[model samples]
Target chain A: MTVEVDVTIKPKRGVADPEGENTKKALHLLGFRNVRSVKSMKTFRIELELDAETTGDAEEEAVTSAVEEMCEKLLSNPVIHDYEILIVGRQIGN
Target chain B: MTVEVDVTIKPKRGVADPEGENTKKALHLLGFRNVRSVKSMKTFRIELELDAETTGDAEEEAVTSAVEEMCEKLLSNPVIHDYEILIVGRQIGN
Candidate 1:
């Protein structure tokens, strides 16, 4: 089975987001005065090849755990960013 | 009234994703061998200020149109990326 996950990462509250700030400035320059703020986030759509026998609840749990581990290990900086993991779908892989 | 929208931008199908590729390599090196592929995307959560009286359908439509314009102008590169807009919520701003 192949499980697909989307991990969204965003700067923690009170943390500086220069990219977002820059974008807000650009929008203001472009005459989008109604724009109040912009928060930029990074999302990773990851496909994982899992054991064929794992299905249903087990598959969902397994993918969630693995993806969380990936986020803790590399995808997110816990000190500055918060991450959310969402299991999108599963497909049988040959 | 304030409308919050999330704009997700991703590389068009078949386009190269070096950041995602690098992340995959790093994950593989970190022993996440099950990772088949990773596609990275950018999301912008934009808050827009609108007339206090505009609510319901008119508000929703106005926000959507303004956000689409933003995506077309700066949030996304039309040639290599595809974009999606999601209206998240509305709030009364004092």
Candidate 2:
């Protein structure tokens, strides 16, 4: 089975984002005075292949495990950032 | 004028991405051994308000200037990162 996943990681509110702050300041200079706030984030779309009789259970388990491990190990900073995941593909046994 | 812009910044190839590298290793452990490579990147979607007779020229200028400044000053390290921008909105004098 082939699966595509989209993941986004962003700094939690109240955490300082220097890049976001600087962008806001630059916007102000560019005549966008009403700009409220800017936030920085990371997004990724990944394609993976798995082996299973159906796309439902096996693929789900593999994707979930892979993403969880990825997040814990590298995709995000547990202390300051949060992540969201989206799985899109044909469901098995559907 | 109101505009929405999406920006992405990523490390250039040949530049080591420690986070991405760590994630790839983690994925391997999770049974995704066939995974080739992983790259880390940042994305931002910004909404801004500008003043002008039309959403076209005013917005185009404002967004372009703001993004350029943001990229140069904070969003990326010119030496090792690159950025891409997308503008989506109603064009003026369409």
Query: Against the hidden true structure, what lDDT does model 1 obtain?
Result: 0.92
Q: Write the per-residue lDDT of candidate 1 for residues B3-93, one digit (tens) a residue.
A: 8898999999999999999999999999999999999999999999999988889988888899889989988999999998888888897
DockQ of candidate 2 against the true complex: 0.29
Could you estimate the TM-score for every candidate? Answer: 0.89, 0.61
Q: Scoring model 1 with DockQ, what do you get?
A: 0.81
Error at B44, model 1, angstroms: 0.8
Q: Give the top-scoring candidate (TM-score).
A: 1
- What level of docking quality does candidate 1 show? high
Per-model fnat list: 0.99, 0.37
Off by over 4 Å in 1: A52-56
Clashing pairs in 2: B1-B50
- Model 1 reaches an interface RMSD of 1.2
Q: On residues A1-94, what C-alpha lDDT tens digit does candidate 2 reach at each position? A: 5566767888887788897788788768866575656777887656566664646666678787877677777677889998887785542221
Chain A TM-scores for all candidates read 0.88, 0.74
